[model samples]
Target: MPLHKVININSSTTIFLWKITESFEDLFDEVQLKDINLIRLNTMKSELHQRGFLSVRKLLSHCGYTDFDLIYDQSGKPYLEDGKHISISHSHEFSTIVLSDQNIGIDLELVKEKVLRIAPRFMDISHLDNLSEQDQMKKATIIWGIKEAVFKLKNEVGISFTDHIFEDPFLLSDKKGTAKLRFNEGVEQFTIVFEEIENYMLVCALKDE
Candidate 1:
């Protein structure tokens, strides 16, 4: 019942976030999962993951859908039976989903100093220059979320975060930017938006038409 936030990105897109605070039994009793998901849920070894999975179902209900109306591709990307695009993400105590009429991707990540340590692996570290350590961690986490969102949007084989995706330079205060995917002998662009949610960063990528 901890429906944390609902963001109306546009007329056709919205994001829902849930702060996981319910016990496993409480969530399990509330969400009616499909047989496959039930089996899959039972197989999760981590209780946090189980809670995250169940929390997503709570978000689905908020959007007027159910487990029965959702399906996943061979790549494990989730989609809506009504043909609306959907993307999901969770980390630690939070879970989020973005439902849009257009192809879109979203990511939720906890801000941590660890991301600053791995910044070079997936982003242009120059973007982090001139910022204090705290700001750097926040910006790095946002960049990581940008790459993850783009990856979910692409959902292709052989896409390396470091080798394939590139985020353009933007101020952390801007809260939105652009990125490019250079792969398969073609270039595609995406509009990126992000916001700070408590101690976590929430990012969304919308494929350019």
Candidate 2:
């Protein structure tokens, strides 16, 4: 994977993702953030490969001309002081950020067989038992991608998957699906399209009237 991209799938909305496929070493060399941002290696979530991710974020903050300290709401939503709506996602070898005027959420996942084992809990039986031979790993990733996006948009801890699931037409076997989301009587709720890049899946959720 090479880190050289800023593909704009939808330019009108400024909904684009910066994907860096190179090693974190390359990312470190490309962007400098070691000065203002400190990695609290002593105390932080284990999920982070270490405090290295914070530095990556600091690099993004620098690009956005933002000062660092982002606070997380009880719902686990990360907030930026500037009013620029944003969403970010990173996987084993990829990192992405989605920018928009409206509230936005993003998710990235490395396709794996484990996703199939866990689909039943979040997905209805229709998602599982109904798949034809046409439904392949790539196809299943589409549903997971959209659902992941919705989860980011909602950002509420207790929001049940059953209540928040999309009800529009789902994609047939081996195809990607799109839908306009309606979540918890909210304002300007939306469901953006999902796209595949490299070996990862990306979902973008936005709120714009």
Candidate 3:
């Protein structure tokens, strides 16, 4: 019931976010899950993860769907029975889903200092130049979300964040930018939109036409 935010990205696309404040039992009692997801949920050792999983179902309900309408490919990408594109992400107390008529990806990440330390492993360090340490962490977190969003959008093997996905340089104030995925002798572009949600960064990538 803690629907934190809803973003109408366009007439055909929307993003839903939930702030997890319910007990696992409460969430479990509220949402109905398919047999496969029920088994998968029981296998999750962490209650936090279980809550995140259940919370996604709750978000689906808001969009007028259920676990029955959601399907996952062998590559672990999610799809809707109605044939709309779907992407999901969860971080700490937050979970998000982007539903669109076009191919899209969404990611929610906590703005942690650790992302700055690992910046070199996943992003172009030059993008972090001329920024304070605080800004660096925020920017790095956004870039990480950018790569994750792109990966989810591609949902292909051998797409390395550091090696294949590239985010265009942009200031944090921009709130939106672009990225490219170069792999398998082809290049694809995506428009990236992001926002800071409390202590988390929420990013969504829509494939360029």
Worst ten in a row by lDDT for model 2 = 34-43
- The lDDT of each candidate is 0.94, 0.56, 0.94
- Compared with the true structure, what per-residue lDDT tens digits does model 1 show for residues 1-209? 56899998889999999999999999998989999999999999999999999999999998899999999999899999999999999998999999999999999999988997788888889998999999999999998999999999989999989999999999989989999999999999999999999999999999899
> lDDT by residue for model 3 over 123-209, one digit each (tens)?
889999999998899999999999999999999999999999999989899999999999999999999999999989999999999
lDDT of 2 by residue, 1-209 (tens): 32235545455334434444445455444443434233543344553443235334643654464434454567667666666666667666566666666667777777777767776665554644555533545455666666677777767666555556553455543233444444557523455566667766776665535
How displaced is residue 165 in candidate 1, in Å? Answer: 0.6
Task: Give the distance in Å from residue 68's predicted Cα in candidate 3 to where it truly belongs.
Answer: 0.8
Pairs in clash, predicted candidate 2: none
TM-score of each: 0.98, 0.70, 0.98
Candidate 2 has a TM-score of 0.70
